[model samples]
Target: MAELHGTTDDRNEGDASRGVDRTLSAVLASGALGHSERRAKLLRYLVARETSGEGDKIKAYAIALDVFGRDETFDPNSDSIVRVEVGRLRDGLRIFYGECTDPDLWTIDIPKGTYRPTLTPPRVEPVSPPQPAHLNRWALIILPILVVLPLLYYAMRPAPAPEPTAPYPVLRIAVMPFEAAGDHPNLEKVAFGLYTELSLDLSAYPWIAVVSPLDPNEIGADYALKSQLLWQGDNLQTNSQLISLPEERLVWSKSYSIPTTVEHIQDTQLQITSGIATSLGSENSISPDLIVARNARNSKPNLEGFLCFISTYRYAVEPTRTEHLRLRNCLEDAVDAFPEFGEAWAALGVLYMDEVRFGRNPRPGHDSWAEARAAIDKSLELAPLRNAPLMAGVVLSVQAPVQDLERARQLGRKLMELFPRHPPTLALIGSLISEFDGRWPEGHDLVQQAIALENAPPSGFFITPAFFAALQEDDAAALAATAPLTTRTSETELLLKYLAAARNGKTEMMAEQRVLLAQKDLSSDADLVEFVKNRRFHEELEASLTSQLEAAFLVKADE
Candidate 1:
């Protein structure tokens, strides 16, 4: 019977492979290939290798030899022709799939790092368009009912018996159901939302493994996070605690108050969730004491990877060539040790891009852009929905040597669709779209959404709005926008201040800004102009920035 099952499985896979082959033939014949003989041949060779069960063995050397007529002397390190052609093939496949109306067909992709093609069948049904706001009122009407049923079911279910403690270098923490401290309308829903959202936010940190429906047996998780929600006037307060399992020792605790209006219950939930997640996982904002202690006691590869990521984030905050090289090596090691770590791959991509930004690509003959693109692609493939990978992809698409405006827009759309309320993605993508793509109105709307989402956004978030105000010659508006960003010491911040000061005719302030900018490396007129141009500001605003920098430099030169 076992042999028969194996035979049946193999037969099914064979049938699928045949179907995929047919689909590939159809794609090749279609106009989607656009008469590119090279792309067509490349696709054919890759599919043939994959269908023959030699996908794992497919390599650039093999492709160059078989398809590109490269001699045995072909060197993949020196010659990027194979990689270039494969990229075109990927673009061709994307076009084909975009035009493909057949939902039943398999989609082919030649993922980075290898020439083997992956043929994946569509697993998800197309989502139907959402009903209008008036129609969605039905969902709101039934929302309380939906919320109560789940609570009732959970309350009645017998508690999971505690299991034996599981060993771990990677710690597992369970999120138990949040308890309500007092009777309040919709308090049950709020508690449920906290439990769900907190679990999701904590899981964003790749080093920590999160388990739900806490097993009392402690079989999988070493720690448990508990929360209590209560009403305080118009505000909702959430008090959270983390306890070591088995020992039942309190490890960490925090209290948060969120103003909850009738219309903003969801926002209240997000606020509470974000607070807890940041305190527990964000290494930069709040020291996650538990994670810090655990890693100090027993430093493991995954923990090291997380630490490397923290270092990477710091480099973003305060960039230096020394820190850049160190982070590059650290992330490279982390990825090599644990290839599946998506955060590490994302950070590695960022470091690669930073090297290019600072004009410090360490490897002489290698293509850093290609390396960055590959690392970013791998990260997205590993963790598509995560903020880090998405942000890295967005950065690459816009800031890399070869900008992909379409890809940037696609990533931006995904961020808005999946994480509409996420402030970091909103602010970063909004700024990029506005500054790089010149889609100011749409981008500004996203930036406003981010501002509304977070009370105290970082100074970077204000750059685009300030620039826009300056462009319109609204000096007051520009100064008001730049006020919050005064504490920042970056070149960009100094440039913003210079622009605002110049607009207001504050000669002293403008001189101070120039001095500050010079300290940050823009010392001369040529240097300032080049720096502004290197920023690749949108075409509409580039002339204004160039003119401003040129004028400032001329003043200093005359002085």
Candidate 2:
């Protein structure tokens, strides 16, 4: 009759007699079952079957009939009534256990992917007080001195008149998260990438200070910058706004459509950056001479293939059938337009590899894998170790169905040696691959260095640290890293909250997350996981990492 698994029993008549009474009493009187009659009936049915070791027979069809009055001929696939009610039963158990304060109580749960009910006895770790008496004593002695010294110093100083504030408040501009126009995960990445690029570009002006990625509406900044990113037809459309927060009006707004070919990407970016800086009317405006000088360094700003390559590069970040087909077609046209463009060929190769990895083919059994190899080889032949080809080749090394981790590592080292002023995007992707490959310490340091080198990393960059904290099982660190992320809502944000809440045993806090996750209209759990982890493409990448680990172990053994 005892709820705990290791309860004392003679394993004879005494045990047999007690179990019958215990099972019945636990089922009929349990708080989890005391609520809705239907839920109670379902719980009793599941629990009774489980205790008698016939739990396997209590599948969805059986439960539908016995608990919900479904006919024997009921089809669970067509009728979601059983699924819906079972979900409530799970929530009911959670609610029951959440309200119970007893530390030693055994709670019932129906874990995901199964119908069996489990009785779990609470296992509590005993808390201990801090034992470092020396540090505690030092804090007591220094606390008063630290407080009084500041007060005494202030009292002896003469107060001066406050300085006049600037009329425009130095044009403090806060960049809100760029809105992604689609539900696709790839679009989210593209939006975030653009957001980071714009923030970094704008921050170059001495008069502007980019606010942290919090809600712009709540901030008291002089100006607020916001953007909406969309991929429609053959162009990347960005609707940007510079708002005067004090006046509560839009100061400047422009909608730009950059061709997917990306020929004028740098020019478009430069224009937006300079436009905002010039419009601010600050003394430290960017010099027109410098803009001209910067443009002069861009060798082929009007190149047809490179512009298309830019859009293709961003599109492949997280790909789908319709978009990737368009991407591949665009890449083909780019190559045909500029046959000598090595980067275009490399891009075409990467696209084919990714399409194969995603199980999408332009044509059935087209042998894209072979085409990918040939195209990549030809690209390297045309522009060996050149910046454009090298960048494209490195991404292929990391992302293709057959990852060349050695090549990726070499490229990463070579990139650092070359010392690009800003290579944070590559650093970010490498860090992701490191983490995915279970090299957590390496990944953590790589991301740390990347963030330190660039002040305005992509908005999604925050997830790296949160993920690191989660892997280390450091709940407090995870919570702190995720605290700044409360200004937005996404599946990623929700999953992070759920993780942090679960680690702290905040079941009440998890209630909303549970509801949101289980909403009927929410996408499938698998898709949500993929979106959160940024694994929209190359679905089997992580699975391959497992084999990589095994191969690594074998190499270590041989060594």
Give residue 223's error in model 2 in angstroms: 19
Could you tell me which 10 consecutive residues in candidate 2 have the lowest summed lDDT?
A: 290-299
Error of 2 at 187 (Å): 17
Query: TM per model?
Result: 0.48, 0.39
Inter-residue clash pairs, candidate 2 = 1-22, 261-307, 261-308, 262-307, 263-307
Give the root-mean-square deviation of each candidate in angstroms.
26.8, 20.7
Residue 407 accuracy (lDDT) in model 1: 98
lDDT value, residue 538 of candidate 2 = 32
Residue range 1-559, candidate 1, lDDT tens digits: 1111111233366557666778888787654543345566778887777766677667889888998789999998666567656754654565567556677677788764466777765454659997888877799889899999999999999998765232112334667778886655445544554465465465444334455533532232446788887875666777778876657877677776766542244444455445545544553233343333210011124544645664554455557777778778888989898787776798899888766665544678878889999999998888787667888999999988778999999998876665544456677888899889989887876675555333235667777777777677666777766775754457777888887777666778888887887776677767777777777777788898887666655555554
Off by over 4 Å in 2: 1-304, 313-322, 356-363, 367-370, 384-388, 399-401, 429-433, 436-439, 453-456, 479-559
How many steric overlaps are in each model, in order? 5, 5
Q: Candidate 1: deviation at residue 328, Å?
A: 1.6
The TM-score of candidate 1 is 0.48
Model 1 misplacement above 4 A: 1-301, 318-322, 358-366, 554-559
